[model samples]
Target: MSWSIRIGSIAGIRLQLHVTFLFFLAWIALSQGLLTGHAERAL
Candidate 1:
């Protein structure tokens, strides 16, 4: 569907956002921040 599929250009390229991927990225970032002792940065 057009609502879910993107058909456009981002500097001559297309782009899409995946909610699951974003959550995983945030989780990884938070884990790294906590590991280095920056708890505030995690949030």
Candidate 2:
């Protein structure tokens, strides 16, 4: 029973990390796009 609980916790942690990484990746892409647009406007 304890082993099953530990495995569940580990799976949850992995899922959380995956979600965090995806969020950051999306944020970086959005920021990059905004910066590129700003640079074009300046030019």
Candidate 3:
């Protein structure tokens, strides 16, 4: 399923990324880092 929508662009450049997917990725990385006792690198 397509979870991302081509929001917009500028100067002929194309931008693509699912909002939720991006957030989900961030959450995963942060959580993993925190759980691994590396909270300083969570972001």
Full candidate order by TM-score, most accurate first: 1, 3, 2
Candidate 3 on 1-43: residue-level lDDT in tens? 8777787898998777787988998899889998999967888
**TM-score, each model?**
0.56, 0.45, 0.53
Record all residue pairs in model 3 with backbone atoms less than 3 Å apart, i.e. clashing: none
Error of 2 at 7 (Å): 16
Best-matching candidate per TM-score: 1
Q: Cα lDDT for residue 12, model 2?
A: 50
lDDT of 2 by residue, 1-43 (tens): 1222222345356322344566777777777778888533332
Which has the greatest lDDT? Answer: 3
Window of ten residues with lowest summed lDDT in model 2: 1-10
RMSD (Cα, Å) for all candidates, in order, is: 3.9, 10.3, 4.2
Candidate models: Cα lDDT each: 0.75, 0.52, 0.84
Tens digit of lDDT per residue, candidate 1, span 1-43?
A: 3334454667978876655676788899899999999978886
